[model samples]
Target: MSARSQRPGFGWAAPATVFFVAFGILPIAIVAYLSLTRWNGLGSPEWAGLENWRALPDDPDALNGIKVTFLLTLLCWLIQTPVSLLLGVWSAGRQRSRAILSTVFFLPLLLSTTAIALTWLSFLDPNFGLAASLGGSSLLSSPHQALYAVAFVIAWQFVPFHTLLYQAAARQIPTSMYEDAELAGANTLRQFFAITLPQLRNTIIASSVLIVVGSLTYFESILLLTGGGPGTATRVLPLHMYIKGFVGFDMGFASALAVLLVAVGTLLSVLIVRSTGYYRMASDREGFL
Candidate 1:
């Protein structure tokens, strides 16, 4: 048969491609051009050479922001993933509990980030707050622990999403695998390792990537919690860029920070996909043995 006959028309794909180019590719090009220039968010963007990038390291607060951003991303993902997986597997096996637990976990995600941030801000406040009511010190005041507070809030918001993804993957597994495991006298733990996990590899990888992206881009949540901190302690890259661009009125520098944030996010996404063997799992119909 002819190639034209075999490979059909654009149809729906054409619109999607157009959308991608219009919204994605075009914006990226604009941002790329803006990053290399000095702009006040107004007049012409004058080429500033590598001035913005070179100044990044010397900006003490910005450097600290970058460090905290990476730390928070790692902490949130590490803590959230395993809990989500275990709960996902358990809840997927039960109907009523799954429904109730999924609702509970997803409720926070349904709320606006600004609302969640405000709620968390009060909860972590030193006075007249839930944390204080629980006889705990003010999380917002404690620079050492402020980032963890942000992580906790984010985890609480997103764990349900990860669990739902995991459950969906778990439910797709064949019942014969569980039956065979029982027949072989393999305990629940062994059965999970041998059957469930291997099958859920793709789901796990996908969930991790999603979580990483969420943690990286989180702004309002962190902003409200501590306003980037008592002393810039919890200022992450997004917050940093916001402050520099809007608050500091340094559009060029802000764009540079934005570029770095995107670069880091892209790099982490690549690493997560490769490390989790997402590609291999996707191509395999039966999952890993």
Candidate 2:
């Protein structure tokens, strides 16, 4: 007689599980199998065993990619978190101005990643873009600035998404907590740290995990913008893998790199969830129930 009992059984989940297996597990398995063999999409895959994995240690681009990947992740976190958090918090206010401004702020989320990257690429074009107006200097082509340029663009494309996350999370925080803090002589800044920060803790952890993991897979934007150029200054792991796989036709080595990236992304996610106690945190709604 219970409503829970009326719900369909595991049959409803079958479609999702099938889709995941077909798209997710299947490709990973194919890639794992390819990692042990040499192929250039010319003929049948030849068995190369651990040759590709062994070569990773000696590959200069792979090493540089690891370094650059970490650096980008750090920069992205440094840039996106504070800005998104502040914007999200400010927008959570029930005001017409905040609503209108937040709508404009989140408009970037409507654009595709490729569109954003290409648009910025034009702006950074040395000959006729925004750079031409400034000093004919292109950040995308600068050895010292290309990485930062890429980071800025990445932030520009994704900050709206993460800000949406924070905004929703901030809204879920009880308003009564702030009212109580105000009654206790706590100023606005004091209330934020005591009430807002603590409440948004889980959202922050979830967003950080997403940002860090997503940083590992940012190939298209970098490809469209810098092409990992300016003397390998912006070639992260995914881009390097892409070059080896698609550009050089070295499928075997590329598969190995892909496996390594998958492993790292998985491990990093696990570590963050465990360390932050995010998995153990319970929902406020569940407490009410």
Candidate 3:
């Protein structure tokens, strides 16, 4: 083909490419630029060199927020991912069962974060909530337990989404593989480890990426639940940024925190992509048994 004729279609791609460059790339570049300056969202922005990065280490609130953010992220991932996958596998094992169970699992994702938070507020009410009504202590009212309460709510809310993802991935496994494994005298557990799990590795990794990022950045659930209160026990980075920017009106430092958030999120996504072999051209079915 002639070089001129070899050009690809730009009809739909052009607009999307432009949109990304304008809204996504440009904004990220601007944020990177702003991160190095001392602009309080007014007047001229003064150059601050590495001051923000330097301050990040010593800022107690930022440090705490980072700790809380990672803690919450880790808890959600460690607990939710496996549960979702197992549920998905169990649900997908049968057609009718899958429909009913999947619906129940996914119901939480349909509710607004605020609505979910408020609903949990009542459930976790120390005085008269369902917890107390059921003769159990309300998890929300206890500072020692509030973080776990929020984490539980978050995991409960997102489990269905992950379950659905895993279900879809699991359903793609050829029945022949299961039959072959069974013929080899492999039991369910053996088939799962040697056959099923390895097949779903990519989907599992992809789902995990979504879960981790969602848990890290999503604060509405935690915000309404505890407002990062009980003495900053749950003041995650996003909450800290909100308090600093809007409550404290220190736009410069807030923006710096925002930049830090973006940096951390970006780094996390990159790490997941790298560790999961997600960015490569490998097919999802490449390693399947």
Best by TM-score: 2
Tell me the spans in candidate 1 whose CA falls farther than 4 Å from its real position.
Answer: 1-11, 280-289
Q: What RMSD value applies to candidate 3?
A: 3.5
Q: List the residue pairs that clash in candidate 1.
A: none
What would the per-residue lDDT of candidate 1 be over residues 113-201, giving only the tens digit for each residue?
78888888887778888988998788779889888888898888888778889888889988887887899899999999999888887
lDDT agreement with native, every candidate: 0.84, 0.91, 0.83
Task: List the RMSD of every prediction in angstroms.
Answer: 2.8, 2.9, 3.5
Model 2: how far residue 51 lies from native, Å: 0.8
**Model 2 per-residue lDDT tens digits across residues 1-289:** 2567788899999999999999999999999999999999998999999999999999999999999999999999999999999999999999989999999999999999899999999999989999989988788778889999999999998999999999999999887787777888899998889788888889999999999999988889999999998889999999999999999999999999999999999999999999988897655432220
True-structure Cα RMSD, model 2: 2.9
> Using TM-score as the measure, what is the rank order of every candidate, best first?
2, 1, 3
Task: Give candidate 3 regions above 4 Å deviation.
Answer: 1-12, 36-54, 284-288
Give the lDDT of residue 127 in candidate 1.
84
TM-score of each: 0.91, 0.93, 0.88
On a 0 to 1 TM-score scale, where does candidate 3 land against the true structure?
Answer: 0.88
Q: What is the C-alpha lDDT profile of model 3 across 1-289, one tens digit per residue?
A: 2456876788859999999999988987777777677766678888888787687788898998999999999989988989999998888787786677678878998998789999988888878788888877767767677788888998888888888888888899888889988888999999999877988888888988897888778788888999997778888899998887678766667777878888788889889999878887366563355
